[model samples]
Target: MIVADGLEKTFWHRPNAKGVLGSFRALFSGVGSAKKAVESVSFAIEEGEFVGYLGPNGAGKSTTIKMLVGILHPSAGSVEVAGMSPQLQRREVAKKIGVVFGQRTQLWWDLPVRDSFEILQAMYQVDEKQYALAMERYDDLLELGSFINTPVRKLSLGQRMRADLAAALLHDPAILFLDEPTIGLDVVAKERIRGFLKEINRVERKTILLTTHDMDDIAELCQRIIVINHGKLVMDGSLSALREQIGLPTTCTVQFASTPQIQQIRGIERIETNGMQVQVFYDKRTISTPVILDEISKWGDPLDITLAEPEIEELIRRIY
Candidate 1:
């Protein structure tokens, strides 16, 4: 559904100085220096696939998305979405994709939520039957009926987000581009959006490409992850495979009744203790749960235990 070949984007940023003299210099010299934000990156996403694009701040993630969505032209290489070049047929491509930018709202602030959808229905040239269905479906999935008559600016953050999502899907696009759809949202709000996305991808067979800093979003929603760093493609694979490649450790924290200084157990690779709690790192392949539990019991009275998988951000940190 999406293909990018050797895609690249360079941005020229002018140095900013304090005074009018600096402004004059910038005027004469134009952009002071240039930096490559995306370089020789290429990948293909299949139809109905949920792919996560992950990177740190200013790590070319947004640059790649912009090029793929035709928001920004690439300096090098080619992009094709749904068999059409985004550069050549932006209008046609736009109709086939639903975009949700978490940091920005595409709806009119002063208008009622329904008005925004009405405007999009006209712009997308959707028929009354399709429009009514879209509204009914979004209202059902997003629970937008409560605030459908309210002005967009008066809605809560979560409500606004839901409304924006509904607006994006009004035309029933085949591909979805979600750029941090869960940002600044509480747990409940995030789960609501995630469930909606999962349903769209599963039930509707829509291709989805999601970019977010939240590891949980990626972990819960994406089966494949594409990692980028320093303007280059670093890793792209399944979440489990990426974790194995990066050597991200699984943490096992156990609380003991008393502090016990101890040597390494048969399965424990590393051990650290603070007060009455013991933290251990072990390879799941090398150590079974029964063995670890037996070793922990030998130390002292066991109070509690919690096992955690490494988050995506931690994995990215290790990769970079």
Candidate 2:
């Protein structure tokens, strides 16, 4: 459903001084410096696939998304969505994709949320029957009926985001480009958006290309992850496969009845402890979870145990 072949975006940033006068002078003077935000990054996403495009701040994730969505033209290579070039056939491609940018809303600020939906329906030239069904389906899925009459400017961040999601799907686009749809949202709000996304992808067979800093979002929604770093494609694989490829240690935290001395174990890399709790970082690829659990049990009477994947930052660092 989506393809990017050697896609690249190069931006020329002007040298600006600290204050207003210096910035004004520099704009008319020396040559600007060229920075490649996204360079030769390419990947193909299949129909009905949920893939995470993950990267750190200034990692060119947004640059790549913009090119794919036709918001920004690429400096090199090409991007196609639904077999149409987004840059060349932007209008035609727009009908095949839905986009949600978290910090920015496509809804009219002063108008009621219902009005924005109506406007988009007309712009898309949607049939009245299709419009009604879309509204009904999203109202049920997003629980947007409560604030449908409220002006978009009056809605909270969570409500505005939910409204944005509803607005994006009004035309029933086949692909979804979700750029941090859960940013600044509480856990409940995030979960609600995630559930809606999961349903749309599963029931409607929508292809999704997601870019987010949140690891929980990736874990819950995406089956495949395409990792990018420093304007280059670094890693791309299923979540489990990525873990195995990176070989990051699984963290096991155990609350013990007493501080227990942990001896060297084959798979266990390191161990740290507080008063009654022990934290161990171990490579599960080398040894089984059962083996590690058994060794921990032998240390002391365990009260509680929680196993977690390495932090996403740590995982990204492994690729670098």
Give the alpha carbon lDDT tens digit for every residue of 1-320 in model 1. 99999999998888887689988888787768889999999999999999999988899998899999999999999999999988899999999999999999989999999898899999999999999998889899999999999999999999999999999999999999999999999999999999999999999999999999898898899989999998999998999998788766678899887776565787567888888888888877777767887877888788899988777777878887
The candidate maximizing TM-score is 2
Alpha-carbon error at 40 in model 1, in Å? Answer: 1.1
lDDT of each: 0.90, 0.92
TM-score of each: 0.87, 0.88
TM-score, candidate number 2: 0.88
Q: What's the C-alpha lDDT at position 55 in model 1?
A: 87
Give the distance in Å from residue 264's predicted Cα in candidate 2 to where it truly belongs.
3.4
lDDT by residue (tens digit), candidate 2, 223-305: 99998989999889998888888888898999988877677788678988888888889898788888999998998889999
Q: How many residue pairs clash in model 2? A: 0
Measured on C-alpha atoms, candidate 1 has an lDDT of 0.90
